[model samples]
Target chain A: MGLTRTSLTAEIGRGANYTDKHDCVVALAGNPNVGKSTVFNALTGMHQHTGNWSGKTVGTAFGRYTYDERTYSVVDLPGTYSLLTHSKEEDAAKDFLVNETPHLTVVVSDAACLERNLNLVLQILEVTPKVLLCVNLIDEAKKRHIKIDIGKLKKHLGIPVIAITARSKKDIERLKEEITRATDNPSESAYTVQYDDEIEKAITTLREGGVGTRFEALRLLDGTPEAGGDSVPSGAADAVAALQIARTAAELSDEIAKALVKTAEFIAKEVVFVEKATDMRREKIDRVLTGRIFAYPVMLLLLLLIFWITIVGANYPSSFLSNLFSSFEMPICRFLQRLGVPQFFTEMLVFGMYRVLYWVVSVMLPPMAIFFPLFTLLEDVGYLPRIAYNLDRCFHKCSTCGKQALTMCMGFGCNAAGVVGCRIIDSPRERLIAILTNNFVPCNGRFPLLIAMTSMFFISADTAASSFWGAAFLAAIIIFSVMITLFVSSLLSKTLLRGVPSSFTLELPPYRRPQILSVLVRSLLDRTIFVLGRAVAVAAPAGIVIWLLANINVGDASLFAHLTDLLNPLGKIMGMDGVILLAFILGFPANETVIPIMMMGYMAEGTIKGYESLSALKTLLEANGWTWVTALTVVLFSLMHWPCSTTLWTIKKESGSLKWTAVAFLLPTVIGAITCILVNFVFGFTL
Target chain B: MISLSYTPMCALSPGECGTVSDITLGGAMRRRLQDIGLIPGTSVRCVGVSPLGDPRAYEIRGAVIALRNDDAEAVHITR
Candidate 1:
């Protein structure tokens, strides 16, 4: 409710001019995967997110750095190809440059891929004259033996260009020095892109410099809002009258694009020299990864291996943390009592809120800590795009963009993140389909329960062999859920969100060595702690609510019992009793607390949230009629149910339509109930 | 003299190289393609094919891009 630190910093980053203040805003702009974030992290301290692939920086992350005793607020704009395109990232980058007009803007580019990177630099120059070119990733260029002439490039660009590795401390200092100069002097006109004679003559007809530069004129002719979804605004009719041009807007845009590419190519040829790009190393790896025989095998094997590692590794820490939390419970209760605190509040605080929060953290943190890092390592190795490439065909068959594969991968970490990741999908129809169906992939919160259920029911005993079988079973459930996602995606594509699959250019970036230290640190902060924070936020209230529900009486029994009995018939039709169904409804807050709440219902408070053994859990479940049918039904329902509250909130914001959010919720709930009923019906016939 | 043979970019198998002759895709994809240095005379090579042989990876101006058959089929190339 009050002014928090993130909110305060966010205000400064919302395109606010600070010329009157001590802080001068320096905006970092660049192409995707060009080490812009690497530079951002280095200057603003080491805690920000940096990844190997594109689209990692989905928003404008803010931090502050100081040089020459003057503070500079650093705004990391979303990486984009060019300011002219209409992708969300491009729009943000363009909007920040044009609207905010920060004191100084730094254009970060990759030294190895200078030509493609320069395409953005030129566009940024046209947007604002106060731009400093930062040719980062110089180390990677050195390895490739590609040399760039800084002097000649400066002559061509007519701006200050600094070539330095983002990691080097000395380079950052040099960059800081240049920031001082560039802010003080927004000097000397940047290289003007010479279009064809007709286009240049048309630019002369329109106003030139200050509020209406040649870029604006070119955009008026080319950037019509109706033409290719480009954003030149809707007021181009007056400009069209002023120009009296004959060509179509698309043709002028094409000519501008060709001119830009040719300019970038011409400058690149003159200043950049290459012996040979030994991208051969990456191609060799791709030969195995994308080869017909080994492709799917490698993918399945990596998934299986990651699951096996997560299942086996998360076991000890989970139990240890559980035991650790429970051991402190009695002391805290006594401590509160001795302080003359009321017994009712003391009991509720320790038993209700503390227990649920502990369960969420203990069960969720370990698996997420292990799993997110491993997944991020694959991203760092540039394998996520290959996964998208290999699976694009199947997604296209479902009438969606292939980038849904990437969003589905993000779903494995957190479905809320997966829904946000759908922004990368260009078409609204495909993005909506991706968001709605994302719940079919079990996120890390659901993983602990899936692991627990398979261990108790599917695996006969707890041994190495049993755990292997358990991991394999969990993997099978994941595969089943993904198949359901594809099926539901196809169904939605054919009906509600009907459209042909969209075409997107997916860049398969060169595989770089995984920065293991940075990957571990980033995933730990970004995924594990972030997801755990949300879980704890939900679990605290959920714990208190469940405690009150069990404690508050309604006639003879507690409200918990009355509610369970009321929902029993409906739950019975799905093979699970009312309590199991109630657990899912209560679990809407966070998936991590579902089992803990279920245990609370069955035993009514004994051995809840921190069970003594699998055998104890088995007895409680078997007492509630948990055969293989019940276990399988519960598992399927857990996989394909309404998303947790966090994900539904994300869907509402991302889609901006309550109808779509309701569809996202009801689609899976109906599918889950029907599948559970089918399972029970088949089991009724057989057994 | 061998006449220049033109084929859709999707037709180039792995390890094949060609020059972009024309781009026929409309809307944003066409603008994006040209913006990324895939003009008429730019050199491109098919570096890798996906397991399904539908979306192939092409190397253009030092960056590798994977295009689906629907988009790649619009670009005519001459080897």
Candidate 2:
């Protein structure tokens, strides 16, 4: 497929909006886990946002930076191993290089493992001559006793090469100087990989016949020429057709690939040196971590450990935040009373909007603050890929991408983020399967409800016993959700999606010592704060709507009661009351508010006012006829129901189609209803 | 002297080493395999198997890559 000029122009426009304001546009490219993002973040300072995982940076991220008084716009391309592959990331990085034609392209290679990365560097060199090779992670290389002769490699490749550790600013200044120098001098790269004679002849024929360049001709020969460039000349098309015939007859494409690899290996041998082959600590660690017998147990233990930490650690801070917010609420309420604001408006603002906001912040923040850092730390230490590795077979059995496991992990934090994480899956069919089923995993928003309900309804009254049983029950629910996710994914793949799981190369990146400070900062800023901000933005408006529904009377009862009464039959079929059902509907904006909404509805209040403690809330719930069945059904529905409004919006945005968005919304709702109905039926017969 | 016998990569026992002789897959899959240093003549070692025992890790060019059995079967290797 070819990219149209309009789309290419649009991509460039989307990539760097400040193209007009910058002196140069530099594209940062590298293999995954090479700290290419660190270089981008350091050079661009706070102007750039970096993704922590492979293929996370699906789109080009542009940031502005000043070097030697000249402002430059830098685009951080998605990390890819080689441009030759047809993965979404490779297509993105290649399209940007071939179509956008940025002034300077920086290929950041990890110094510790330069050979494998050099394959991409070589491919990129074939595209743009004005390239700067930034050999990052020099410090790590030193730790491994690996040395790279930067000058020799630069000489061999005929491009400027700079050595720097991206985390520190020590070499950033020199990197800036080198980038400026390369941009100013802009030399055509003399680097070219020699292919087989037949392939060379075919390339020459296509080049002379008015093909754009050898790179384009080679891409054409590979039978995967990029889409959307200026239309090929008629003569060039004929030459390409002839070349294809010759290539098929000679099997030249594979030959060309082989030759490229050979060249990369040759160049690497010439320039890279290992002083002493250090012990392969990563391999030794992997043996135990990924060993067949230990992998599953280890994975389970680590997951439990992370959740255990989040649960135990978040408790104190959550209550503290609750107290802090509640204290502020009283003062704000008193101040509103003193100002002589209308009671209705004051109630709506403080009791409705402010209370929901307070609950959401107090409930969502602490766990996210604790959970995201731990997640990021796991990612930084290269443990995530092992999880994916361990889970690959299970996903493969379900006929979906193994990367779905990673996306599901993201779902634990937020389903909206999980939907965005689906970008990592290259196949549209499997990606849709992942997205449609991701809501089966209860996000952090629903955790507060699940934990509370589990503790109140299922666990013993003893604090320690309750906490232990709560964690165990939560784990069981999570495992159930994952099983349901797999089952639904398999069903979708076999039915609507209908495709075999495509294979992908999962790179087990070398484990590195995670920087505690950076992990905390990134997880907090990129994930915790970002997700909280979106939740809060949507929650405030939802608060007003809930208040209106409760206060506005419809005949005898309030509108909220009337709505709940209408939902009563359906809710009863699913083992929940009308109030609980209405709360779920109103809780569409954010799941964190579901319990609070239920509380407000049960209390016959016009707004979500407050609940002093869990036991007091439990008393009110029991007074409103909440049973063990109701709690169980609520937990099950929470685990399986339609995603929140923010997640639905994200689904729409990420899928870019209303049809799939509708499917994503309806799929889980249907499943949740079915599951709840089944549970309620079984329990009614037994009880 | 070289043995001409070939086996699918997945057939190799853990810790068994081989040279990638040919990739029987085509198009994007073949290209992806090559892109990750699975080109012909590259030495590969079966490092370990995942818990469920389908996707196995292989060390190639000093990097570990996990491939499912189905995809691994597409790669022909000579021990």
Candidate 3:
């Protein structure tokens, strides 16, 4: 890894030279919503889930770009405002810079908001001197009449600086070439963020005592520096020596933080010139979006519009897919039998596993396919933080950080992702509150069932009026679940995870024009297909297990019947029958399988199937003694039940406690049970 | 000590701009605030509040950051 100069032209020329692969590692760090992920995508050609919001990248995403006939592996570290804080995600960013010591750390900053973005850049410079300043989103800045003197910033920061908009291929190639050159000849910055006199004296004392570096002394002075656990991999002398620094440099002080902030404010003022009209333009839009009169209505309207679009768009494709899958049953059975398959095997494979797979795919796929991309479009446009802003008071009242609103939004897509998104919340207690209550919102897998039931039972018989009322009613149900989320979050905070709300700086970023094409493709691949693939995997094994439960007879009745009979009394108290309760229990592996399991229980012979119409499904439920009360109770339970297996696993992984995992499981289940029993108990007296 | 001329940051209305006179917040959060350029002498403008009107967005250091009412009131400012 000696310094060998790779010419810029040679680096930019594709397939122009053949040499040994360098495998140079480069890490991208930035403030949230600074087009950091876009730079990663441009450099590595991997669509790494770019979005225009804070904490969009919850964890590191890795990709490789080839330059100068050498492959440069890039790690996109999660965006943070400053590494000065003790946030888990920020610690991850700081840890990577300190420990892994990537060959070059490209500190990406939004050129438009260079003043605030420099706060993080200067902090990273403290950790290691091997940093290249890539001031991104230059085009947006230029459009807003903000000009940054890249050369002046370079000299002031005393680091190599380059400004490039992520859109231009030429700029990305230049970035790659710069990566090569910077990695080859690393220059220590002459500029340092001068702290106040007191901290400087302390640093000097620690420095004289062989504390390795000024940065190490500062880190040791941090309230809680995550250090010294695993620095062996990089084997950098700085990492090793930093591990030896005494923890007695100084108490965490305002002088150090203020100095950093003051320096950033100074440099930004020196290098940037702005017309200042852009904020006014965005403020008008934000006023309407988060304005008192229109905020909730606009949110509800957006939710309704998305649901209406999904319900209407998914109708034809769902039917087509179902018809296509069903139309193949006989041929598949015939082909299997002709190959000398046994009846039991044929029944299990085709009628059981295959039927369940197709049913889940047809029913679950279309809506998710439509809904996720629409949701991703919202995320990309930076509407999420505004949502957090609008809903902050509600969360504050609940003693939780408002960012839970964003995680709850993710829960609308998938509970697992929502749990993972809880990483954005700074407080461990609030993060738990967010995780435990995330399941109160129905995920995409549960949405189709809720919509179906909402339409079938709640609305009037007029087809003309039903569609509008259906969307309204669906939104009402979602709101009810969100209310439950707040209630539970508050309850748990007061009882189990009680604490004052942690302060967080919610940055409402400038909205970017969403990449609609790539959003469609990425959502379809990343979210829809990924979730669908998990459903399929779970649904198949579940199908075979459920077939055994339904078919294998115990006593005079089948095992499924006996099991339902066992649960019948409890189910009666909950307003749903034994079979529905059993279906929910069996559906624990995957919520997508709940409908098929219920269908199997209601229709005799246990042969899996899909109904052609919502009307037909309604008729079947009515025949099975489902009144509007039953339907209401069912929706309530669906909205407030135990999280599915994937979500539980994610909760376990994220929370890292079996106790919390069990609490997450039982909290919702208990609430759902109590809510259902009370509903049934009250209706039992009145209706 | 509390100053006579400094107004509670929560009192600032939309379109009103102020220079931060003091931050009376404590602990890590106070440091967090300072780390983002919210120290004394930085200019902060009350952009607008969310519909619920608790967490208000303030333009600090060329960025719009919304702080909850409780957090906002901790910062003392003067027009």
TM-score of each: 0.93, 0.94, 0.91
lDDT of 3 by residue, A1-687 (tens): 000011111123224322224578888999888988889878988656777777766656777777778888787887888776767667778777886778889999988889888888888887777889999989888888999999999899877888998878999988888888888888675468887665676666666666656666776555345565422223333432453363222234566777887888788879999876456678889989999999999988887788778878988998899889989999999999999999888988887888877878897799888988898899888898889999999999999999999889888878877887787787899999999999999987888788878888899785888877887788889899889999999999899998988887888888788888878876787677766776787788877878888778878889999998899999999999899999899888778667767887888567666666888898899999999889989999999889998789778878999999999999999999999999988887766
Per-residue lDDT, model 1, residue A19, is: 39
What pairs collide in candidate 1?
none
After TM-score superposition, the amount by which residue A471's alpha carbon in candidate 1 deviates from its true location, in angstroms, is 2.7
Taking every candidate in turn, the Cα RMSD to the unseen true structure, in Å, is 3.5, 3.8, 6.2
Model 3 — TM-score against the truth?
0.91
Off by over 4 Å in 3: A1-22, A196-198, A221-252, B1-5
lDDT of 3: 0.81
lDDT by residue (A1-687, candidate 1, tens digit) is: 001122234456566653346689899998888888879878988466666666656557778877888888888888888777777777777777777778888999988889988888887777677889999988888888899999999889988889999878899999999989988987586787888988787666554322255656666667454355334333544555555457777777888888888889999999888998658888999999988999988988898788778767998999999999989999999999999999888888888889877877888888888988998899888898899999998998999888888889889878987887786676888989999999899988888778788988899967889867876787688788879989999999999988888777888888888889888887787667776776688888988888888888889898888899999999989988999999999889888777877888888762246667879989989998888888889899999899999889778977899999999999999999999999898895665
Model 1 Cα shift for residue A518 (angstroms): 2.2
> Candidate 1 vs candidate 3: which has greater TM-score?
1
Q: Write the per-residue lDDT of candidate 2 for residues A1-687, one digit (tens) a residue.
A: 001121223356573554764468999999887888789878887523343356656666666788788888888888898886667788889888998899999999888778888888888877888889999989988888988888899889998999998887879989999999999998665598888776788778877878766777777777665577436767677766776775572266677778888888999899889886533787789889988678877877787788778878988998899889878877887899899998888888887788778778888899989988888788888888888888988899889988899889888878887887787788898898988998989888888788889888898786776777777887788889889999999999898899888877787877888879877877787777777888899888887788889888879999998999899999999999898998888999988888878987888877675467889988988998878888899999998888999889888877889999899889989988998899999896765
Best-to-worst ranking by TM-score = 2, 1, 3
> Candidate 1 regions off by >4 Å?
A1-12, A15-22, A208-211, A223-245, A461-465, B1-5
What DockQ results do all the predictions give, each relative to the true complex? 0.76, 0.70, 0.76
